[model samples]
Target: MKQWWIIICMILSPCLKADNLFIEAESFDKKGGWVLDNQSMGQMGSPYLLAHGMGVPVENASTLLQVREAGEYRVWVRTRDWVKQWDKPGSPGRFEVLLNGKALRTTFGTEKAVWHWQDGGTVLLKVGENSLELHDLTGFEGRCDAVFLTSSLDLLPPDGGNELADFRRKMSGLPAEPEEAGEYDLVVVGGGMAGCCAALSAARLGCKVALIQNRPVLGGNNSSEVRVGLSGLIASQPYPNLGNLLDEFGVVGHWNDWEAKQDPSSARSKQIREILQRHPEKKIHNAGPATNYEDEKKQSLLQGQENLSLFLNMQVYDLRKEGDRITFVIGKSIISGKEYIFRGRLFADCTGDGEVGFLAGADYRVGRESKDETGEPRAPLKADRLVMGTSVQWYAEDAPDRSGFPDCPWAIRFTEETCVPATRGDWDWEAGLDRDQITEIEYIRDHALRAVYGNWAFLKNQSSKKEQFAGKKLAWVAYIGGKRESRRLLGDIVLREQDLLENISYEDATFTTTWGVDLHYPKPIAGMDEEPFLSYCDVQEIKPYAVPYRCLYSRNVGNLFMAGRNISVTHVALGTVRVMRTGGMMGEVVGMAASLCKKFDTYPRGIYEMYLPALQTLMRQGVGKPGFPDADKLD
Candidate 1:
């Protein structure tokens, strides 16, 4: 984190309005130990710096501030005490803003449960250049959004809404309009398995494509940050070649080279056998090590595409629609605060959250539908805001030496009765089921963090079997929450449980969904009172079924396409198709459709209405080779 090279040149412009100097924490030159967390950028305004040291306080995050006036500047730091909602004991996310090595009079992230500006009294500074450091007090999840230094005594920052947005824009000196990011035939607004495949598939079919991901990496849930292995059987019939590109994508050369080899003596078969035999520890679902996901390989795979332009660390927040069809989408960099515009003929919302579709005024649904409406056996009696929870997966490994963890009275405590009786967390360790998955994501993630730390603290400090956990230390606890269900974008047909159970096939059947109808709910724990941290998965066994192409394209939005968990589906149907592998197949189909649209100058609906045969031909024979354009094409 040697940040001296990142010179803080703010307050240098003469056209600036006020003497107030505002700096987004993510813009720091050298972040040192702190990580950029923009998951809650929609809820909160800007991305902030998070001190995710687990229990141990990380190294200092230093930055050089160019102070113009250098007088008595009243400092205000935007932050929140994440665990304060439960009204727990300790302030785990406490930190201080240091100016010129002198700690501020006020410690931030100690009070407000919601995001607010915490006044750090006054600090005297020298004119030219000054040192700014975010001093972390607890290794827990401390956060700082932006550091505000103003000569004004009475003016305070807006909590949120349009006022705060305009205030930050004018003060931070960001452009009023977003920077243009070139036109494309297709713009996929996510970097998940579905989005990657959609972008790759379209690009391979000779369409100019743009793949935009909010995070620093390409893969969303399967990235090393989230550490979820690919699920659902790939390369299934009616179109066995729908996932050929995905088959060639794996961490090591072993699985990446696999192509339905049956010969035991062949090198490819032997290599596949060896790698799977070696990496038995990596689970197929969640809570695996970082190396298993292969973020680098996925990044390289997308970047290697000839017609695909991949942009990481970019989040699409808004869109421009002429009538019902989307013309352009706007995204901003999560780290540098730079905004870019993506003008495209067709748009795809693979953002598990349906961000692009939502921006386009497309119809979408959240939570379960009433059984009366959907006629599904497992549907809730009433349509409510009870969606599936998100998982904050974690794991522990044997430490080199025995060490004791700190007491976490502020965290969710576990008695001997409520102790999970486990050293690691998996898909079951979920949170934020009842809350809004889109708006209150930060709250959802923070609650899971407390559960993880709290459960571990009990096992290590208070449980009768504490001796067993004495040698174990938390290796990884994913801060990037692996979400299960959220917004389900509505299409011409909303695939329901009956469709999968009855094996009803559509004329435009596309990808095969093999996973069972898996739905998750809050598990009832014995002693815990609040929303349960554990999840109870109620799964209904079902044979392989093909999903119609109607579910892939939007019903009203003319040019919009969708893939991933966000595709048109009932809450019940989402269980089977939401998995990464199945979503990848959806991307493959969407990408192929995007290519046909580019080739014919037709919309997403045109392919289903008139050009269905062409799409079927492309599906029968995929775009061929990972980055090879038109290797196996109908054009």
Candidate 2:
């Protein structure tokens, strides 16, 4: 990468004095050069007060205005006492100022009586037109009565100037030397629920296990980042014993048809609600719902486990092996920019994206298998051209007492489509506000939030039931994208949709995923009105399918195993396994099989033959019914 720096200077005519151009605001309630960004109201599609008017304190209120002429200047202001309930120590009541949108160090600590303007803050005014801003960091408690500007520019080194430069310098430095990852009996990549369970299960067996998680936080889609609730089988038939371990670990919550109580009842609210109501006992939370994996560490949930070592924010960069004997692996950290080298006897590819298998030179499939490849009825004659796109979500709240629309940053198309009134059962998935291109995904998500707020404004101001939308508001915008599908790894056994619906039970079955066979098509391609194409196979439901251990291991890389949606399956088969519970179970099995391999000092494939009894023992300990119960139950 290259760097560039450029600066422009404008000279002012002598007749134009520095004193002529200055804008000031005494309050924010009425046209004081302030606007409420009502795009997100708290997931409720409504508007609320933006600044001092809303319940939010005014001490940290931000104000921006233009000044036509520039000169060295002294800026001062008075502020009332900040409300202590929301203020913390060392926090100035009238905090921070900005020049030309860049923040300046300006503050009035809460020490004296009301409205006392202090002195001694100045900045060098560049020789042209400039913008001056005063930000109310504490919440603008006292009124901002007036402004003072002078020709004396005292330019001190800007705050955060070196801090930012240091950050950039650090980012450019070479990453740390890779850690020496010793020969792990079993190495599991990806740290979602399944991967976590797998790591713990193997470690508990006295096997030295290394768990690699690409993300800082685990739980996969069910994690707080993606926010997709878990749903799928709790126990494979006759395997209630297999489901016991997950049940003990809060995995039983996804079986419900109703939404988790913590879920927001916005556009897709009904769908979530329906799921939760249908399955009342599933474990779920709405807010602070374990979105961060570091939270798990604080709780000490996995502490004191001798066998497992969970590495966060680390990604598999490469894998080295010959024939079936895998030797070592390479990993890189996303944050500290560190790399690691791990030598493991057996590895599991739970990265969901199949990063492990792919790096190990495994044969993988990126799209749907042709009908000729699977012989499944619903298989397309050829691969479909489009793939599912990812989505980000937002939240909003309604205005109090059905007020007029707030000055939110709503797009033109949003205001046109968001004129509806709020009613019970009014939210719809189809009510979003943009096209379906990947480049425009964020555009749609933002507009969707804006549309929700705008419609709520209409409800509060003009709709027949304005009274009903009085207090709803948008609260949050999910920090991460909710992805649906991506690359998949080819394994020793390729699972077809026909095998699922036909209920083919493999002798080497490790777990079963019961989410209904489902598939989503990209919105109709341009110039075509009907769906681009749909097969009878795509249109129908398939029965629960048993996943064999073989499908989780690589065809090319012997020591690598895969879990989650990236397993060897046609696109149609992935629709079922993509759900949270199934992914979790897959991780659990992979971990246990890895442990079994470590105990035998062999690879994952060896577990099926030489360590079948121990694998059975692990299955009996995990979720799903223990297959071949008479053979060997894991102690």
Say which candidate scores most in TM-score: 1
What TM-score fits each model? 0.93, 0.61
Clashes of 1: 3
User: Per-residue CA lDDT of candidate 2, range 474-535, in tens?
Assistant: 33334344555566888778887878888888878877777767766533223423222111
Tens-place lDDT per residue, model 1, 1-635, is 12211212333453342356777898888897899888989978888889998898977888877766767888999999888888888789999889999998898899889999898998887887788999999889899998888776665666688767766776667778899999999999999999999999998889999999999986788888887767676657898778767754563321322221434675445645555566554334466667767788788878888988999889789888899899999898887777888999999999999988888889999999999999998998998888888999998889998868888898787899888878668888889899998899998898888888888888889899999999998888888899988899999999999999999989999999988999998986887786678898999988989999999989999999999999999998999999888999999999999999988889988998999999999999975443322212211
**Pairs with steric clashes in candidate 1:** 1-32, 89-410, 90-410
Tell me the lDDT of model 2 at 360.
75
Measured by lDDT, the strongest candidate is 1
Model 1: how large is the Cα RMSD against the reference?
A: 5.4
* Poorest lDDT segment (10 consecutive residues) of candidate 1: 1-10
